[model samples]
Target: MAARTITNRKARHEYHVDETYEAGIALTGTEIKSIRAGKANLQDSYARVENGELILYNMHISPYEQGNRFNHEPKRPRKLLMHKREIMRLLGQTREKGFSLIPLKLYFKNSWVKVELALARGKKKYDKREDIAARDAKREMDRAMKNRHRE
Candidate 1:
C-alpha cells in the first residue's frame, strides 16, 4: 500500500452514509503523480452513474508541478472501474428516493488508486444538529474519564 489518504471531510458532516464501495480510478500519469504527492481533494467531489458507467466529477488532482504542458486537468471527470453488476446496483440505489453517491475517500492500495464511494442520503437540519450534540457529549465523557484516571 502507498499509504496515502484523500478524505472528504464535508461528506461525513453533511450526509448519512448507508453503504460504501471501493472502486478503482482511471487516471493519467500526471494525475497519479499529483496524487502521490498528496495534492488531491475530494471535498466537493461526487460520483454518478452516467450512461451505465460510474464517473467521478469535481475531484481535483492538482497539476504536477514539474509537468509543463503534459499536466492533467485539475478537475476533470474520472472514470471509476467496477463490476457491471455493482454499477447497476449503485444506479438502482441512487435512483431511489433520497439516495445519492458521495466520494468518501481516495487512497492507494497495493499501488492501485482506489476511491471509497458511499451510498448516502442527505441529513436533515435537525439530524445534523443531533449528530453534533452526540459527538460533543462523547468527547466530554472521554475527557471526564481521562481526568478521573489521572487523579
Candidate 2:
C-alpha cells in the first residue's frame, strides 16, 4: 500500500520544532478506516505524557459513513506507543520553558499508523513576523535573480 501522510501546516507556523519522534498510534477499527479515507485532522491536536504514557488529545478522525452503531468517537484520546526512556525524556522537556509536544503529522508505515511528534516551543508574534519578512525577502531576491539572468 502507498504511504499516506497528513500534515499540520499550522503547527510549523505557530511553533518552533526542536526535535521530532515517530510513534505508533493505537487506533480503533472504524477510526483506522476513516484515516485511510483521508478523514483525519491533526489541527489543534497535541500529546501529553499522562501517568507515564503518552496520550494524544483533540485529534479528530471522522466517523466512517458506512459504520453504523460501531462508529468510533470523533475526538477521543488515543494512546501513543513509544519507549519508556523516550517518554521520560520528553516529559522533562515539555515541563520546562514553555515547551510542548505537538503532533506534526500522521501517516501509514507498512500498514501501521504512525504519528510524527515534535518537541516545540510556541513562537512569539514578533518571531512570526520575522519569519514572514525573511520569506518575502527571499522570494523577492529569487525573482530579481531570475529576471537578471533572463536579461
Candidate 3:
C-alpha cells in the first residue's frame, strides 16, 4: 500500500508534543475509500473528550467521487476509538495542566485508518523562537561536520 500523510501543519508550530497515541477512527466505507485515495486533510483537526468518549473535530475527509447521496460529510465530527482508561487519562491530563489533544497525522496502517494524536502544550513566542534557533544551530553543526569529513 502506498503511504500517505495527512498532517496538521499548525500543530507543530503552535504546540510542543509530549506524547503521542495511535487511535482508530470510526469511518464509513466511502470515507475509507476517499482516504485511501489520499484525499484527507488534518490541517485544523483536534480532539476532545466528550461524554467520556474522544471525538475528533475539524478533520476533512473528501467525499468519494463515485459515491452518491450516501456520501459522508467532509467535516463531520468523527468518533475516535480508544480504550476507556486511555480516554480517562487523556481527559485528566487535558483538564489539569497545559496538555491538549491535537491530531498530528492521519494515515492508513495495515489497511485501517489511524490517527496519531499528540498530548501537547502550547508554546509561547519566546519558546518558538528558541526552538527555531536551536534547529538552525543543529543544522549548521551538521553542515560543519559534513565539511570536516569531506576535507
Candidate 4:
C-alpha cells in the first residue's frame, strides 16, 4: 500500500526550516485507525523537549467513526520517540533564540506512524512577503517557459 501523508502547509509559510528529523509517534489503537483513514490534522502542531523527552502538542487525530467511549481524544499531546542523543541535540538547538521544533508532516513508514519534525526559526512579516513575491515570480517564469516550449 502507498504511504498516506498529512502535511502542515502553514508551517512552511510561517517558519524557516533549518533541519528535519524523522521520529516515531506513540499512538493508541483508535488514533492509529483514525490516521489510517486520513482523519488527522497537523495544523498548529509543534514539538517541545520536556524533561528529556520530546512531546508533540496540538496534533489532532479525529476519533474513529466506529469507536465508542474508547475513542481517543481528537487533540492531545503525544510523545515523539527519538534517540536520547538526538533529543538532547534538539533541546540544545531549540535553546537558541527563535529556534523551535515544528511538525511538518505525519505519515506511515512501513506500518509505523512517523512524524517529520523540523527545527525552524519563525519568519518575520517581511520575510513572508518576500517569499510570496518570489513564488509569484517563479510561477510567472514557469508559465513563460511552458508557453515558449509550446510555441
Candidate 5:
C-alpha cells in the first residue's frame, strides 16, 4: 500500500518553524487502524514535554468504524518516543519565550507510525503579512519568467 501522510497545513502559515525531528508515536490498536485509514487531524494540536516525556495533545484520530468498545479516544494525548537527550534538548528549547512544539506531519515510516515534530515560534500579524507579500511577489516573478520563456 502507498504510504499516507497527514499534514498540518496551517502550522507553517501560523508559526516560524526552526527545527524538525522524526519521532515514533504510541498508539492503541484501534487508533493505528484509524490512522492507517487516513482518519487523523493535526489542526489545533500541539506537543509538550511533561515529566521528561514528550506528549502530543489535541491531535484527533477518529475512532475505528469496527472498533466497537475497543475504539480509542479521538483526541487522546499520545506519547512521542525519542531519546532522552533529544527530549531534554526540546524541553530546553521550548522554555524560551514564544517557542513551542508543534506536530507538522503524521505518516507511516515503513510499518511504524511516525510524527514530524517541529520547534517553532508563533508569527506576529505583521510577520504573516510580510510572508504573504513575499509569496505573492515570488509567484508574480515566476509567472513573468514563464511568459518570457514562452515569448
Candidate 6:
C-alpha cells in the first residue's frame, strides 16, 4: 500500500462504508506542497459527483508557509480525477436512497496525491453505540489474551 498522507477517521464511525475507490486530486502547487508537509485535515470533508465529474468539498489544505501571495485557499472545492465509467457508476450508486459520496482518505500514490472516496450509508444512533461496545469488548479480549501468554 502507498503511504496514507491524511485520513478522515471519523468517517468510519459515522457511516457504514460500502465500497471505496481511489482517484487523483487536482491540487495547486502550493496546496500540494503544504499537503506534503502534513498540514492537511479531512474533518467534515466530502466528495460528490457533478456533471460527469467528481468534486471534493471542504477539504482543508493549509497554505505553504513560504507561499506568500501564491498560496491556495485553505478550504476550496477541488476537482477529483477519475474515469468516466467510475464516475457513472458512482452516480448510479448515489442515486439510491441514503447513499452518499465521501472522501475516506488522502494519500501519496507514486508521487501523486490521491483521494480514497467511499460509497457509504449513514448509520443510526443505535448503530454507533453498538459499534463502540463491540470495539471495547474486542480490546478487552486482546488484552486478556496477552496477559495469559506472558505468564
Q: Residue by residue across 14-131, what tens digits does model 1's lDDT show?
A: 9999999999999999998889889999988888999999999999889999998888889999999999999999999999999989999899898899999999999999999999
Model 6 over residues 1-151: C-alpha lDDT tens digits?
2234798999999999999999999999999888888889998998888989999999999889999887899999999999999999999999999998888888897799999999999999999999999999999999999999999
TM-score of every model versus the real structure: 0.96, 0.94, 0.91, 0.96, 0.95, 0.95
lDDT tens readout by residue for model 4, 16-74: 99999999999999999889989899998899999999999999898999999999988
Q: Give Cα-based local distance difference scores for all models.
A: 0.93, 0.95, 0.92, 0.95, 0.95, 0.91
**How many clashes show up in model 1?**
0
- lDDT for predicted candidate 3 compared with the true structure: 0.92
The count of residue-pair clashes in candidate 6 stands at: 0
Candidate 3 residue lDDT tens string, 1-151: 5667778888988999999999999999999988888899888778999999999999998999999999999999999999999999999999977888999989888878899999999999999999899999999999999999999
Better of 5 and 6 by lDDT: 5
* Model 6 lDDT-worst window of ten: 1-10
lDDT score, candidate 5, position 49: 97
Clashing pairs in 6: none
In candidate 5, what residue range of length 10 has the lowest lDDT sum? 1-10
Query: How many clashes (backbone atoms < 3 Å, residues ≥3 apart in a chain or on different chains) does model 5 have?
Result: 0
lDDT score at residue 1, model 5, on the 0-100 scale? 50
Error of 4 at 94 (Å): 0.7
RMSD, candidate 5, Å: 1.1
Candidate 2, which ten residues in sequence have the lowest lDDT sum? 1-10
Residue 96 lDDT (model 1): 96
TM-score of 2: 0.94
